[model samples]
Every structure is written in structure tokens, then in C-alpha cells.
Target: MLNSVNRKVFLLYPNLIGYARAALLLLSVFAFHVGLLRFAVGSYAVSQLLDAVDGEVARRLGQCSEFGAALDMIIDRVSTIALYFAIAAKSARAGLLIFLLLLGDVGGHWLFMYTELKLGESHHKNSAHLPPGLKHPTSEAMHQKLMIGGNP
Candidate 1:
């Protein structure tokens, strides 16, 4: 087996998927730019689905790496921001709300990742510093609060 440090993680299946996601997002943005709404939505949706698969593929193939994690997050943030900006262009009033939400999304991710690096964490998802109840998004309490029709 190859040592972790020497592995060609960029070529790993998960990272390959990440690259594909980046390409798809690029296409998505271009499509949106040219007003090809169907193509934009289709590429973006497929990219999002691939994002869900990459991490699981990484775990199953023993290919998870910090680089892949960062790539995934970067692509995800870009996708979200691009979509938000497109939507924000519709109306000034609602655009402000969308922009604020986009700000929170980007700011929160940056803060979380920055803190992780500052604290020398091995994984971006490390939330041990948080209380047990809030350590995970899938936790029962969070699920109930976040699920559709559950609560605001």
C-alpha cells in the first residue's frame, strides 16, 4: 500500500469526482450566464449529486484526503454563490435577502475551516469543540429543527 503522504491523491476517485464537479460547475455558470436555464440547472443539479457521492466514495476506497475535502468545499461554495447571485439579480428587495444569506453561507464556512486549521485539526468536519448535542448536523435535535415542515 502506498504511504498516505506519497499517494497521488489528486488522481484518486473522489478527487477525480471533485474535478468533474468543478468542470460541471463551470459549465453551469456559463450556461446561466448565457441564459440557458435548463442546462444550468441540470449541470448544477448533477454536480450537487456528485458532491454527495464523492465523500462516500472516498471513505469506501480509502482515498479521503485534506485536499479532496478542500476541493469539495470550494466547489460547493462556488456553486452556491453563483446560484445565489443569479437569483439575486431578479429584484433589489429580495436580492438583498439572498445576498445576506449568501454572505452567511460563505462566512460560516470560512470561519469553520479557518478555526479547524488554526487548531490543527486533521479533518474539516471536526466539531469536537462544540457540545455533543450540536456536534453534527444529522443529530436528532438538528434534524427535527431543520427538516422541512419540522420547525423554523
Candidate 2:
């Protein structure tokens, strides 16, 4: 079911899916804030699931451009942060936890990007063959001695 053909179909609908996900997330946040929407949490959860689906679809369809990945990541981060803030506003007592979660989320993304960049560079310089599943390494993994400075 998760084949390339299905993935391509999914990619073709990215704009629709992306917009729907965004709308749902916003609605969920608004509902949560208003205290009238009982299923706001469920809607938010569904949005998150759709976010994952869009990414996997893009990747499997060979539509995984850097721009697309970046866009998706940015959207995901923004939505998550917005939700965190919304919840924190509802309960001031959770402020510290929200702050910590935001810090971890941002820091983790930065670290991963940095490592990927380094690995990519290393792959380009040293490895002759590409990585089994990856298109290319973003940067060389300095810590791993096995990877030569070139493409592999």
C-alpha cells in the first residue's frame, strides 16, 4: 500500500492535504482556547498524523526536495509551538514544561540539521557510492572514521 505509485498520488495532493492540516490545527487551537470544543485534542492529533503522512508521501514519491523538507519542518514546528503556547495559556502552571518542550524541539532540530549537513559534505568529498537509501549525505559525519570524505 505504501508503494511509489501511491506515494505519487499522495504528493499530487500535497497542497490540499497541507492546507487541510493547517486549517485543522488552527481550528483545534481555537477550539481548545474557547473551551467549547470537546474534540479539539482529537482534531489536533489527526492533523499531526496528516503531517507525517504528507512527509512520507513526498519522500516515497521521489519528491523530497530540500525546499519541501524545509517547508514541512517549519510548518510542523510552528504548529507544535502554537499548540504548546495555547495549552500553556490555558494553564499557567504548565508554562515551565511547555518552555522545556520548545527548547528541546528547537535544539533537536538544529542538531539534526547540523549533523546531516556535515554528513552530506563528507559523502560528497569521500564516498564513491551513494548511501543505500539516501540520495546523498548532507555533510560528513566527522565522528565516524569509516566514511571517507567522498560520495558513498
Candidate 3:
């Protein structure tokens, strides 16, 4: 009989996927700097797709961790901010909207996450601390709807 044990490493599969996504993000930034706009946009697009893949991989491999989740969230915020900044740089007229969008998207999400932490609830789940008159929908589903403008 042979016995096998699973040993977790700092560079787990899901985390590796995250690292790759981060690399792609960096590549996109470099491409943009070098005026390769098409390549930059394409790389950024792939990196966004990898973000979802990492979460799915974590779930399937039972490798989810607090560090991974937090890292993912941080990366998401940074990427969003960077993208918005790039868009805003194109014209002054669009800058105001980008600023408002950044405030709403980044600031709002941070506040929501902070509230969930303080209330001792999983950030994605409904909990007793939910504000009055608000329906208790899972954060995951709400996020999906908000992101894609459709049902999760």
C-alpha cells in the first residue's frame, strides 16, 4: 500500500495562477508605456479572465485561504484603479466620471468589506448585521450581477 500526503506550499496552484495574472497586469502596463495599445488591452483582458479562474481553481482544489482571498481582492482593486486612471488620462471631460466611478467602486467595496469584517460575517454571505430593509443576498451573486449586468 502507498500513502500520499498533500503538503501546501506558498506557491500553490491557485496562488500561482494569481501570480501569473499579476505578471500579465505588469506586462499590460509595460505595453501601454511602450505605446503598444492593442497588446496592452489584450493582456489586461486575459488577466481579468485569470482572476475568475483563480477563484474557481481554489474552490476545486480545496486550496482556498485567507491570504489568497485578500490578495485577490487587493489585486482587483489595484487593477480597476489602474484601468480607470488610464481611461481618465485620455481627456479632461472623462476624468470626472472616472473619479466618481473610482470612488463608488473602490471606496464602496472597501467600506462593505470593512463592515462585513467588523460584523464577523463572511464577506460574501448574508448575516445578522445586514442593515434594515436590505434583502440578504449573497455578496457573490450581487457582485456577479453588478459586474455583468445580468443574472449570476
TM-score of each: 0.76, 0.62, 0.74
Task: Go through the candidates in order and give each one's C-alpha lDDT.
Answer: 0.75, 0.62, 0.72
> In candidate 1, which residue pairs get closer than 3 Å at backbone N, Cα or C atoms, i.e. clash?
none
Give the lDDT of residue 113 in candidate 2. Answer: 64
lDDT digits (tens) for residues 40-131 of candidate 2:
88777677767655555554565654445555566677787987897788799999999999999878866666666666632122234445
User: Whole-model lDDT for model 2 versus the true structure?
Assistant: 0.62
What is the clash count for each candidate, in the order shown?
Answer: 0, 23, 0
Per-model RMSD to reference: 5.2, 11.3, 6.1
- The numbered model that scores best in lDDT is 1
lDDT of 3 by residue, 22-138 (tens): 889889988887899999999988888777667767777888776677777777877888788778766668988998998998888778778878878754334567564453343
Q: What is the lDDT of residue 76 in candidate 3?
A: 82
Q: Considering TM-score, which of the candidate structures 1 and 3 is the better prediction for this target?
A: 1
Q: Candidate 1: where is the Cα deviation over 4 Å?
A: 1-7, 130-152
2 versus 3: better TM-score goes to: 3
* Deviation from native of the Cα of residue 23 in model 3, angstroms: 1.0
Model 1 lDDT at residue 108: 90
Instruction: Find the 10 residues in a row with the least total lDDT in model 2.
Output: 143-152
